[model samples]
Target: MRIGETAAAAGMTTKTLRFYEDRGLLPATDRAPNGYRDYPHETVSRLEFIRRGRTAGLTLAQIGEILAVRDIGHAPCIHVKDLLAKQLHDLDARIAELTALRATVAEFHEAAAAGDPAACDPERICSYL
Candidate 1:
């Protein structure tokens, strides 16, 4: 398949495919006499794996590491597991931080609702903000 066909199969734009290639996340493709990219049938599956990794919040470098390991005939199972655990831990921490922020905002909302707007300070930004 050509770049267009491969991109369509991967559910992404041609530019995205090019970006992945430029980023070295994708391997170089074969070229036709007309100077067009040619992809194998397995490229679509590889694209799907890339898409899944991105959706799972893995960085390009991390995905590249995983792919590099696989390219070397290694399963990368343990490495992937450790990376996932770290990602999950970071996500949990961010969620907790956001939850606390939400609680603070709720308190501010309540206080603002009960306070007198006429008493607002003229030399400073809104305290609620």
Candidate 2:
């Protein structure tokens, strides 16, 4: 398949395919004698896997590591599981931090809502703050 056809089949733009190639996320493809890229049909499947990995919040480097493991004829399932576990742990921590931040902001909002504009200190911007 050609680059455009492969990108369309993979539901991505041609530029994204080129970017993936440049980033080493994709294997090097053969070129036609006229210099256009000639991607294999299996490239579409690989692109889909890359898309799924990105949607799961995996970094390109992490995705690359998984691909590297597979390229070396090994099953990357264990590595993928470990990576997902770490991602989940990190996501939980971020959610906790965001929850605390939301509560603090809500309190500040309540204070602001109850504040009198006339009572705001001139030295500072607002008394509520």
Candidate 3:
């Protein structure tokens, strides 16, 4: 299929397909007579996999490494397992930080709600914050 057709089939923009090609994530199987990129049917599934990886918060480089291992006829099971473990740990840490931030913000909101504008201290930054 041509680039536009393939992108439509994959539910992505043509520019995204071109960007993936430039990033070495998508490889074109052939070219049309007019020299436009022609993608194989497999490219659509590959694009979906890439989209899922991005949604899972994996970087393009990380996805590329996993793909490289798979392309080399390896199962990539160990690499994928290890990568997921690290990603999970990082996510847990970020979630903790976000939870703490939420608590802080709630406290600030309460303080701000109770604060009197007439009592604002000029010597310090906004006490509500």
Over 4-85, each residue of candidate 1 has an lDDT whose tens digit, in order, gives: 9999999998999999999988899899999999999998998999999888677888788667766767555877668657
Residues 27-98 of candidate 3 have per-residue lDDT tens digits of: 646887889888888898898989888886778987886666556675558766787677668778977988
TM-score of each: 0.60, 0.60, 0.59
Predicted structure 1: lDDT: 0.85
Best by lDDT: 2
lDDT value for model 2:
0.86
Segments in model 3 whose C-alpha atoms lie over 4 Å from true places: 75-129
What stretches of model 1 exceed 4 Å from their correct place?
74-129
lDDT of 2 by residue, 1-129 (tens): 899999999999999999999999998799999999999899999999999988867789878877776677755577666865776687688679889999999999999889887776677864456
Better of 1 and 2 by lDDT: 2
Q: Is candidate 2 or candidate 3 better by TM-score?
A: 2
Error (Å) of candidate 1 at residue 87 is 7.9
